[model samples]
Target: MRNLARPLLFAFIALIISVILSIAVGSVDISPKDMLSVIWNTLQGIEGSTQLASTYQTILLTLRLPRTILMIMTGAALAGSGCAYQGLFRNPLADPYLIGAASGAGLGAILSLSIQWPASSFSYLFVPMTAFIGALLTVFIVFQLAKVGTTLPVTNLILAGVAVSSFATALTSLLLVNASGELRRALVWLLGGSTMAGWKPVISQLPYALIGLIGLSVLAYKLNVLQFGDEQAVQLGINVNRTRTMIVIFATLSTAAAVAFTGVIGFVGLIVPHILRRITGGDMRRLLPFSMIGGALFLLLADIIARVLIAPQELPVGIITSLCGAPFFLFILRRSKGKDW
Candidate 1:
């Protein structure tokens, strides 16, 4: 009962408050009551052709709403991947990028920006698709290199991810070095950006995040068992290798898709899981769900700070999180004595 009670309650409440807060606080001041009424009416079509106020509707439909939904999706995707990566490698310091998603995605974006490629310039949505393709390709290449017969060699997997990440960074830098003015746009994006979340990117991410989250949730029990070390898990009758592979694949897809939309929003994934671990211990069943909620609220609040910190000019949400996370990380480093590198 104690195990189930607190984490579940916190998860539910955090989601509710974050959603409301995300909608209410944005570039334009939106009172909660009016915003709720606007959402209800638009969703229910209570106004029909009468229409909501043009400014209100624009902010609600276009800016605030898309940003909020994107935040939720990105949060789930990162947090989910973070959980999988930490569990997969049995390393507390592990993050979603360990799979090569960020590296490949950065390469793709750098290419697009170098060529002065606007997403609209391509009929097939080249930038995001390119990022997705790069990410999937990295995953493919890593798996091919790391897999031995029917199972993955864990040591090899980690090494492959590191090698891929290093290669991607080198490639990204090389691209940026020779890039013309157009390609330079991607350079900022490579670091990460908060360019307004569009409907296409948001819709594209919805299915991937939902599928990955649902799949991970169903595998939560196996993941929990797998965390007890591979040898022990095998002794307990868990299909250790297969379960690990499934979770790794699941994490890869979610992180890649979300990164395609929101360029490299860091720390939400890494921070949420660690904080949740402190609160709930390292139980995957509790860990995964609570991580999702923590990710959501963390980003939602980060988004709010991003919007307001610079006033009319918004700081990228990733920047805000990094600014906050960097200091906390250093504090952690100091406290860790000789444990962390």
Candidate 2:
């Protein structure tokens, strides 16, 4: 209990601080007093509180609030998915996009933009919905390719994901080359950004993300058994293959939904899980929730950096994460070299 409490408390505090910072410091800075007034006025459904500036209210509603919600949701989804993936594969290096989900999702979004699909398609859920399908299909393909008789080797699975991701990326690039006017849109989706700041975007993604999180939570105990290896897992009455399959499916769904809306944001999935796992021990039950909060906090901070680093002109959120994540990735690689996880 103490072990779980530590990460949870740290993550909760970090999340609160990150969120407040995200709200306060954007292109237009709002003071703490005004921020509170805006929140109060908005909640009371009053158009104007005498003390509130309408512009600040607009910024809070039209920009900061929705973006914050999206960030929280996307970050949690990626982090939770990462935790699930790592546990499923028994590899700390395993990320949510390990099985080509990001690449495939990008390809789907590119295809959507390339075809100039109407927003009315799928009730304005066209790009995200297509991306979700593509991600799921890509992981399914990678799983099938990695299968050998009754067993799946982790090495082969990683290799297969790499190959599929490469293929999907190449295809996406080809579409981009022919994109003409849609090139910027294609590039943004492939690279990742949080330009979709609205309630619709948040609400659209919430259901799939919630479903995936719940599924992983239910399977947490079985994932712990899986860490003991297949023989031990089977002896413990855990169906290893089915559990792995479900983990893949749910993690893919959460990751797909996140990437579909936010583009291919990396490292939240990779970095958050590892950080929380160290604090919370190897228990999936504790690790999953901690990873969720930690991921949310980390990405919120990264997004803040992305927005303010260039002032009025914002960098892609993916770039910030990759810059921060790449070094950490290498550090972990060096530490894990010639050692069994």
Candidate 3:
């Protein structure tokens, strides 16, 4: 407990700072003072009485707030799921997209974009819904391919994921080639941009994120036991197959929900959990929650850089993550050589 306290404090403070920065550092910069003032006023039911300009209030409330919230939720979801995946596979390199979730989601999003649905309130839901469905289906297929009789081998699961991910990526590229008017939009989304604005995304993603995060957290002890290998875990009275399946389902739910909205943001799960695992050790109970906080902090900072890096010309947040994550991935790969992670 003592060992966990300092990191927890640091993560909490960093998360708070990131949230404030995310909300305050957007296009029309709002000072932390004014941002807090407006929030306080709103919470106190005296929003109109605040001295802040209406434009500032509108921007803070209607735009940045929801965006920040969604980003936090998305970050938490991805990181938590990533940690679960790493534990489930007993491999430090595993990530939220391990089972073709991102590729499948991308394919689904492209399909929706190809249709070019008319701009309407309900239309925003189509892309996310379809992307989530695609992710679930893709996972189901991977599981089927990987299953040998009643048991699932981790090696086969990973191989199937890689193969299916390739197929899905090819399909996505094919669709992109034929997608006339929506080409640029589809590309931006594939590269990890939040297309929908305002609060709808937050509302839609909340349940899945909560359920997945909670479910993973609850299963942390089981994940720790599974690290002992499937045969030993089974001898210890753990239902290895059932536990693995539940972990996959929960991790996929969280990952799919996030990708459905934020596009294919890579390396978040890989980066956050791996970093937290180093600090907190391999204890899933500690690693999982801290990864959630660290993920929010990391992504909010990434989104901030995406907003300000080019000033006025915003890059996709996924681009920022990849730029940072790709090198980190290489470093992890090199470090993992000749050692058991």
Question: Candidate 2 residues 262-292, lDDT tens each?
Answer: 8889889988888666678788988898888
Worst 10 residues of 1 by lDDT: 116-125
Best by TM-score: 2
Model 3, 173-216: lDDT tens digits are: 89987887777877777788776679988887888788889999
Question: What do the candidate models score in CA lDDT, each in turn?
Answer: 0.73, 0.82, 0.83
Candidate 2 global Cα RMSD: 2.1
Clashing pairs in 1: 113-183, 114-183
TM accuracy, model 3: 0.91
* Cα error, candidate 1, residue 231 (Å): 2.7
Model 3 superposed RMSD (Cα): 2.4
Candidate 2 colliding pairs: none
Pairs in clash, predicted candidate 3: none
Candidate 3: stretches off by over 4 Å: 44-52, 112-119, 124-127, 149-151, 332-338
Off by over 4 Å in 2: 49-52, 118-123, 332-340
